[model samples]
Target: MNQSQQPDAADPKRRDILRWTVGLSAGLVLAPLAGCDGGSDDSFSATVDTLPEAPRIVAKNGLIDIDLEAAYAHNSVQLAASAQNAYPGESTQQATDLRSYNGAMLAPTLQLNAGDTLRVLLHNKLPGNDTKYSSLPYLNYQNSTNLHFHGLHVNPGIIRPGVYGDYVVDTPDAGVVPGASRQHEIHLPADHTNGVYWYHPHLHGSTTTQVANGMFGAILVNTPRNDFDLPDDVRDRVIFVHRLNLSDGGRSDNLYDYVNNKNSAFMLNGVYQPTIVMRPGEIQNWHFLNSDVFYPFNPVLDEHTLWQYARDGNSFDRVFRPVNAATSVQMDGRHWPGNVLYPGNRSSVLVQASQTPGTYYLRAAKAPSSTGEEIVARIVVEGRPVEAALPSPHRLPLYNAHQPITDAELAQHGGKTRAVILAMLNKDSDLLVQPIPAGEEWFIPPGDGVSLTDTVFATGNVGTKLAPFQSDLAVTQTIALNAVEEWTLYNLNGYPHPFHIHVNDCYVVKVNGEDIEPYWADTIPLAPNGTSDQPTSITFRSRFTDFTGKFVWHCHALDHEDLGMMELVEVRT
Candidate 1:
């Protein structure tokens, strides 16, 4: 064979030790608190290390049986560098006690195949919570928690039958409260749509506080690897992004803060400004997950291209740049498209290190101009050249829902449309989620959907909005099984909300009635309404095929979800 005909290096899908750097992104609310926000381009001597990947529990013989425990890490946990960010969930002065899954700040990553039986015996060893933060009297029960399989299409049934696959309601199963343990068995079907998903506590009151304090991890199921036909030298990395804030004296940062393993102002795999060492022509598959309790992050690698592979755990038909994702952080003074990852969103991409590279950074350009830019990570491409080729991401044929919901599928559901108003009937910062399930009388008197004499709750309207879970209420939104439906998500409030749904991924059809490329995702940003008469809206179609029972759709800004911007829906067979 000629020089051009030589085969590429093997794809081992493993990581080798390489030195790197990471920095914390200073958000507007966090800028003042992150005085010691880890190393930057200057602190090479602080600590150069391999990205900290949480230990993986891979399935063996089609079964992954593991004992997972949750407890408080009392002592300070940090990297070897003194310059690292101090991640004390309570105080900026010292590393305080924080909750963790299996004693890990980032929790264990579960690797499984499509037909794997994931049996986990979760032991909740944490202490009881007695603090209340908001209007809801039950908002501070931090000890009461349950695991929700973020994107897995599993049954949310009773815990006695098999396990609590994705069930989060407080009725039958009261969740794994303090000192209690529960075994969860989730069996992925032989054709489960596979890629990267996540697991986190979903108990109503403490969901945001716990997740922000580092109770989340990744789940890689049936990665479409052999379909790529690559060798064994390729590197597969999980880049889980999170925020760890500190409270100084009486001035506390947002309650949305979570204590990740790393104490950086902003973190990637529990470290500040983590660097990924690579050689020219080397390819790496990265699972980019945004686990921040609130806010979306738009990441731009200085010179690299994030070849889109999948979104929300479903693979695309082919490789393509995601809509609005910037190819690179352009130095030109022009505004570029956004590759935004809202809270609870994940993007899997393939990046090839340029042949002659120096130092590149994974940076973000947020809004409000002044506090918009921060470096997420550093990528140093200088080493022995590895001859490698990136295959097409579209080649992977996932199970069902790999493609867009077709027009034929929508026709079966009969022109049925449901609406939800994203408003703030309370404080400005608070998010109000008013679920307007179909069949409700549309009384057009300003609040429009349903007419109420006094409280909307008096007429089973949920009192205008759900507050702090209100766990013992009737679910007005009931979805029919084996049907595809379009949903109108309206952002009536002036700010944006990352709308997310469980058990199914939806294809974005339009924004404010304007048709756009149908992008499939479990989470998508509903643009701000800006107090306009015509609120910002997103229309999406989703198919609820296999698995039925209770699940939720909520604002992915987790704090907002904790407050009330979440709705429970039962899919009846």
Candidate 2:
């Protein structure tokens, strides 16, 4: 069977799986208030079992060379009982079980410098027949996978010709077929942002399944800027969060089963309620990566203020303390009292241990019932003070600080504006037959008798009929070299989506018509319409100053993206 052929959505065999997987009838609405519990309906009791802390592995040289081989593993988790009453018609308890992964439940951390080259040799050791339970009529290559360097400005593909041609940037084609292996080369520019980034499987059809099984890792790019200075005695920790729902036999029947049943365990660094010992008056830098396929978490450390200085690997001009911190001078529109980490987002926060020692809970203040307000980790401050004074916020050198795009530059070269609407199409939508824009090419999968809507499953371009990093489709939206362009991403979907662009970082200028502090980020959240009829929009500006090639823009909700919500853009010299 052709790998790119569109799956027959109407096939009787396909219907069984489609009914259980593809449809999400309602949109995810934002929960009111910061600490309110969004209640659950399972019957199994929550566990309190805890595991030993996992080791943090940092890269030795400038190169991040590693091998990722898929395999199965067992992990234990403890789900705490809810203090708030369960919502009507919701489950009161849910059981916990061990799940599988590529190796361990969580991959190791891959650390590097700003100007480093990442050479990864990923071996596809996953069983080729893992898709035997799949219901999709087309190729359900669950064992096939690839890697995406999230939030990195790196080349998507090597130069070649024709199908494997140079500058084509074939993102989907980069996948490693089952029983095969592939080498991925990524070069981070000399001035790449210095903070937290991540890597995960991006194979279109099996992305959710692979990531759900824990094929992810952290990539930290170090810098010498004083603004990001930390005390020599301070400990740096990576807290990678994931939500998993395993059955009695320690496996899920389908990729969407976790979504439908709401039986999940929220984990930090692959362990439940892992305890971290700290000294009173000591400060620590905690880097967080939200690798969940769909869930969003707003984290708060009780009685502790989070001094956030970075987002999506890009550091801000000044450190931002929570709005309620006593030392916080003033509140910037971009500053918040807590950190909200959506899917595909990364953040670094400075946490100071209380002067008086005690145990504190670091948990998500807001999350869905499957993993709502659960205690993620425990911080025990039982030792004497390591530092006499509390750490002060640092004013770091921002990325591209010397090449700030001024108003004059905008007026001169930022005239190009592109509008994008993120919407979902059904059987009744006109987009099913909408023609591609004049002179703009549409990516047709390798199969005959496939409709545009059918192509959505194959290419992930439902309402827009666009393809992932297809150079021809992006020609119409070509950006001139070194040009600063303003782009507005409107969310027409019923739920919120995180808009992410590759190869460039953007500063959010306005959201929902309200002016905001221009903060640099590679991923920005697009709010849902809510009760309003009009879709919410966010405007941002990005400078295409450096390298030119094909890259992609898409919803950071990996599931939404896999089902068709990505487009290609080109920077032409």
Candidate 3:
């Protein structure tokens, strides 16, 4: 039966049993009973809702001008009355409300050429006042909002002198306040890569809450890199995988409640287990984005092989065939055998439909520890098989290519090398935890433990202000425009974290002191620090070229980023 019908078929006695047996004051009674670990184990029933196809918006004449807005709208997904009541204030009433681009549940896909100009007049129609439950002590900017052109090598914004305030192009200028409008101009360079990119709310402090409310969309930059392409009749799909916590009614102010309550649903295009139809042996290009704030999705087609062609919006010269390796040096340390899209990661893969032509499942083999083996999409293969041969991997053009930093270039432009440590800040912690030194301008939100701090630099009077950090001890690494520098990132936490940098991409040179094939990437995975024996570290070289201003590098885990695991870097002229 379809998802909408399953709820009606549910035994009414189940609700009565839950309501009477489990008291309302206890927060979430169903989450635990429902196995709220965010996994697809049999204990948790699969969602039966039909998947909705995401809408697309293609550019014309190398230009895309649109009116984007962040406002409240209704989602069709139905939640139990008890689930809705778990939320505190207006959030309970706005359980169906979502903050979207152009009022779409899953914002429209923007298609453009490499050199296209994107002009968006963003109108922030969010409520002027914070949610009625805003009295809580924490940073919440529900009423204020901005936009970020993720993965595009465009100017974030220009910052002027005293005449103008700190105007960051990537982030909004004081945000598009309630009923206010702001214009964002982005010019994609002629040499920009042809691949998949995305956009979302980027205002700090409230990014987690706003994004959790579903304020994001996709951007596809088309370029003529490969003359040979998928059959004209082949269907191309963009899958935005995101998570929504239903317990707190999907409210920005109650995100903490959602996190603490562990009430969430994994969805594709805002629906559960939608069926995608394909023909036997048909090769289709699938662009996937992990829009979830903290979940890392390891997608696996039940019996099919996913040939990956791009990573983080940059196309590689050849398709990557998953292989088993004993050590990290054999293949890229970031990706597993199959293409795994970590949080904030994007990938384009070519899926060859099974020749047998039957129903199969697209499952997330590795998700957040709490969630296991969850089904993301259902593949229904039928119809006659398509006769086509897979394209030669080597013949694919390198849509985005970056020359490795030669020894000579490194020697000439190399600046100060820095070592940063990612750690926890709990007082009872002995896991390489570091406490914030005295007299730093940064304040740790109550109960925050995750932090990114520099080990070599001291508090205050260091680095450029453009790349400043919240705490005096969290030093900003300064780099001259066009400078080349090596950064060594150490992970002291118990779990793995994906590190991502803005503005410029980097080349991975070594991992755990072992050299590997260098490749261009904006994000890299760092292994966890396990039991005293295995210490984790990653070293990469980056060139600060082209557009220069203030940008940030942080853990892609949105929750960690919101907590404090982020640092600013300056590319000064």
Which candidate should be chosen as best, given lDDT against the real structure? 1
**C-alpha TM-score for every candidate:** 0.78, 0.75, 0.77
Tens-digit per-residue lDDT, 443-478, candidate 2: 323342223323331123224543332224422357
lDDT of 1 by residue, 402-488 (tens): 566777868967656777665544322223335533333211123322222112211113134433335334335688898788888
Candidate 3 TM-score over all chains jointly: 0.77
In order of lDDT, best first, we have 1, 3, 2
Residue-level lDDT of model 3, residues 506-568, one tens digit each, is 777777667766666777767555223454777788878787677677777766665556777
Model 1, residue 296: C-alpha shift (Å): 1.5
Worst-scoring 10-residue span by lDDT in model 3: 26-35
From the highest TM-score down, the ranking of the candidates is 1, 3, 2
lDDT value, residue 106 of candidate 1: 61
In candidate 2, which residue pairs get closer than 3 Å at backbone N, Cα or C atoms, i.e. clash? 40-90, 40-91, 41-90, 41-91, 42-91, 160-165, 160-166, 161-165, 460-564
Best by TM-score: 1
**Model 2 lDDT-worst window of ten:** 27-36
True lDDT of residue 320, candidate 2: 69
Q: Which portions of model 3 show Cα errors greater than 4 Å?
A: 1-51, 78-95, 131-138, 159-173, 223-228, 248-254, 323-338, 367-370, 399-401, 427-469, 530-534
Candidate 2: where is the Cα deviation over 4 Å?
A: 1-61, 76-102, 129-139, 159-174, 223-227, 258-263, 323-338, 367-372, 401-404, 430-477, 530-532
